[model samples]
Target: MPEVLIEAVQPGSPDTGAVAHYGDPVREQRTLEGAAGLVDRSHRGIIAIPGEDRLSWLHSLTTQHLTDLRPGEGSELLVLSPHGHVEHHAVLTDDGTTTWLDTEPGTAPALLDFLNRMRFLMRVEPADVTADWALLSLVGPEARIPGIELDPPKVAPVPGAKFASADVAPRPTTVYSTAPLPGGGWARRMAYGYDLLVPRSRVAAVADELAVPWAGIWAFEALRVAARRPRYRLETDHRTIPAEVGWTADAVHLDKGCYRGQETIARVHNLGRPPRRLVLLHLDGVSTDELPAPGTAVSTADGRDVGFVGTAVRHHELGMIALAIVKRNVGDDEQLRVGVSAAAIDIP
Candidate 1:
């Protein structure tokens, strides 16, 4: 799905090259909170891995346990560098014959290259199908769209996927689903939603069928910050480990078999500490209406830099809040500063 296509479906003023909201961002946020809004995430990337050995092969490479992954079940996984830094993050669902991997934008090319090189004569093959498949999401509360029925447990694994064969790929009829994002840790926290993998050719039509107000990335980002969800690019740097952002809860299987970065994970876990910890900072709205920008310096009141802000946004109800990584020793009552505003830590 191209930016132009996204613009075409969007109902309001363009925030950038893409339309960020439909007239009022706060209204869209409210719509999403009621689970009556559609969010276009078509810019994200999607990959298709098809072969008899897809599950076991993915099990050996990623942090998630895919070996026993039941068909239609969704799991979040991470690819770590040799030194244990996060390299890629994906939420995937395997339908027996093929595993669909959904990842951040601009991630598919590199991920596809990495997978191709790692094949090593295995029966598994992976391809970038982002141009053919797009993603749409419905968030908040029970998060149900009118026409889509998502029942992962009842669907059995099968070999007749529409895109099973790489050479003769066809648009998939089945819409794969992911588990709801884990949500909590703040007031006015809305339940996170699930993702749907739909054909790119029909993305506009599918979104139209929902009959709900549309939300842009702005509303989604605000909600994500309030929910304490960590985005790979925003929350992670070159040296970030999964433990730093509490990603172990959803993305890492501590007891899983060896992968590229297992040693670092084990060392960090056994030592009982990571160098940094993720925290939520409530910026003082009275001092400044503006929130700290991503990568803005977050420091102790005395001016010692502790860490950088990952994401900062004004929630529809939570006021101004931001997610930052700070030294683990930063006390619960410590007052931090982001730019000109004083910040209070919201415990995760």
Candidate 2:
């Protein structure tokens, strides 16, 4: 069924573009977890890197080991500050000729600038292609769409890892599956899905043709929070590091050689723990109308601030919930508060 047009609302984050829902968020989320639901992600940015030296050059700069990356394989990586702060995150796939980067909206400019400045003598050329390309996400139990051949590769589990490697299938539209949460297994509760890259002109037509229901960012955020998936913008700040939110398993390759932030990552992983860790907050009495906004202060029961809320929503089944990064010492069983409402923390 086609989505009836509705007023766009902010999705609780400043970086996130307006468009909270496409009619019904709760039902849309149900569709996403069952069969499939098409989400319009045109606001997402795309960058194309074309050249023989692309992979090697990228491998030298980011947290992932990309030199051996196979065409059509999906993987995520992070660009961090010298102090190990997460500056950028991208889910990328390489075709034989060009490597495509899918990044959050408004991130392409900075990423493109960084890439361009570092191109010293490499053959690679990176360009923003958001104008020519758009993203449509088909999320649910199976990544099925009509008239497309999608064979998601079998992903081997990484025992006791924090995140799993992303898997993908080769296709013209370029489909990549999200890695299942908690690293090494699959669960119906996790919104494991695929992202499809289509031409800017065809996104609307493609969304219209999909037989499944349509979802908005609101539904996506709720599922993401429930899965404890940390978004680039919402879950990070000036001092954020990959270890804080379990991004190391999926985005960082410990065996890889030097990168800008490798020193800090190595030190933290080997010698100590990150100052903060990500957690899922069950908002005790929060209703849809009373959902805590992102950046709301999270404090101990006695009123000592520890962290801030990242994303919060009234889930269809889980009532109200959120994702937050708190001090590493915060006890798992401790009572927490988001503003005036009490919240219970679940370490993800």
Candidate 3:
């Protein structure tokens, strides 16, 4: 991993944590936007759920319409605490025999435990298989990678970009769920591209052979921030509600049956606003001199603290932008400051 993303570091650029780019951040980002690029998403967790009642049992435990989910279908499910806070989110793809749950890297343990605890009289079996399975993603203009093919399920779009496209048709990338692996595999049209779940032993071979630019953690962070996608710990916490972070529309089903936190979800959607709202902050200028990091305190004019930056990135197009969860009353046109910076950020 270090050999590709770090040891071959680019001078003058920060090369850390499987880094943002193999060498060039902007080039990598452009190829990712205009053409295609392959990324190592092995850091994400994979949980295998198998049992006779796998779909139904899981359908009743989380937010989503999974009871009737088909073998090759895909959807995002949120595990909310009984109080309605987002506890976990799993990108799902079922393969007839088992349901594959792609979780946040460090969250599989607790999610697995929660699933186990809720299995009192059910026949469901959940296993944290991240160690056995490796994940990889391909993003950009191209779709339908070779050796794998599955009709794209009508899933959520890429939330459409903020400073880009208006229509959300055709999807960000095509699906690739079918594979000819002897060891079995999985894939989905998720994230901003197609994600493949293959045997761990095969990850390196596939990664090395991809004919596309490589994007490390940093590049992906920028795109994710541009996409305005929020994760468990970064834009979420113990008290964070799905509605607050915009997960309500993508992951929650309003007409669905009961689940752990349905009451709170209903109460908020029907009668009240989430205590907070997710916003995209286009920082004042092109000065990357003092880029704000996550957890950087946010405030109003003249020093009134308002919110904290959830995720910040030097976007390929948007320069510096951030995803923030601010109080619901924070107006969309409200002028805000990041940390003590004099430049007021815009909620674009």
Candidate 4:
């Protein structure tokens, strides 16, 4: 498990869990409510691909349309095993000679090691930039910061909002536009390119000046669940494939040329159905006093193992809701029991 580092933003304020380096709960809530806030995601992996063959080298390894990615364009992609298991899902962006890969924190080292093993005398070089660059997430309504634009025009924008990036004080910055949610909620992230390290003493001052919110892992987990995003460790594992997690819409590119797991992805897309499907579960008659453990069996009224719960939360408005991976043939409106505790969950 990744250890969350807690940093205090204000004197006597609650210690915040910085998933990367700084966590702010107030900022996290603002992020969910569409308020402009910043989050430090620097702890997440940031890999730089430099040198002449950077683009070509990366294109050959990941499953996305990277060959034609423009200087300021970003796309999500997956690194897959030859047998079709998902190795890692990454956000790829290029800034001239170097391409930046933003991935989960703990997963970066292993990925870098794998890429290094496959270097094979290529001109490309891969290096970890987490320590050098600070990742700031600007999200919510009215979150635009001066000079950024969203990429796809069709995606809805929050009122008085646009996405942009800026240089980390005293450093160069690269900004790329991205899609915002419908009805005025969106997220924009900027990576401050630093030539020299910023002192840790001024970290909180920088964060405070930027208005970045402190978010804990719990708050982030809730936001991801609300967005219906599948996480790496909780909802996925070695046996999981990109298609099984419904990541094709964002991660995999079907028309792209041969890459690891391309055959399996194509075959599954064209000829086979996903054995299990992801679903939202709303628990009924449960209070703060009683909560079902994750991985507890979910069975049909007739007692068949339909699925198991993955994550659950107590919503301010919706009571308790969960995410579950269940057998595909299960009816959308079916009522199922979680564990032998008699707790019923309605498929939504």
Q: Global lDDT for candidate 2?
A: 0.75
| Model 2, C-alpha of 193: deviation from truth (Å) | 1.8
Give lDDT tens digits, candidate 2, residues 13-129: 553553567677888888887768877777888999999999999989998877877665667789999989999999887766788888988899999999999999999989998
Stretch of 10 with least lDDT, candidate 3? 167-176
* Residues 1-348, model 3: lDDT tens digits: 233553344333322334556667777777777778777777788899999899889878988867767677667889988899888988877788888888887788999999999898888889999898877777876734666665654544423212133333222122224333445576677546778788989876666655666666667677888888887777876789888887865687655668989889878876556788777888865444467767777787767777778877778788778887788887776778886453444544
> Which has the better TM-score: candidate 2, or candidate 4?
2
**lDDT, candidates in the order shown:** 0.72, 0.75, 0.72, 0.59
Give the winner by lDDT. Answer: 2
Q: List residue ranges in candidate 4 displaced over 4 A.
A: 1-31, 152-206, 285-296, 340-348
**Please, what are the lDDT tens digits per residue for candidate 4 over residues 193-225?**
111112334456555554545544445455556
Which runs of model 3 end up more than 4 angstroms from their true locations? 1-17, 147-183, 208-210, 285-288, 342-348
- Native-to-model Cα distance after best TM-score fit, residue 15 in candidate 4, in Å: 15
| Stretches of candidate 1 exceeding 4 Å from the true structure | 1-18, 146-191
For each candidate in turn, give its C-alpha RMSD to the true structure in angstroms: 10.0, 6.5, 6.1, 9.9
TM-scores of the candidates in the order shown: 0.82, 0.85, 0.85, 0.74
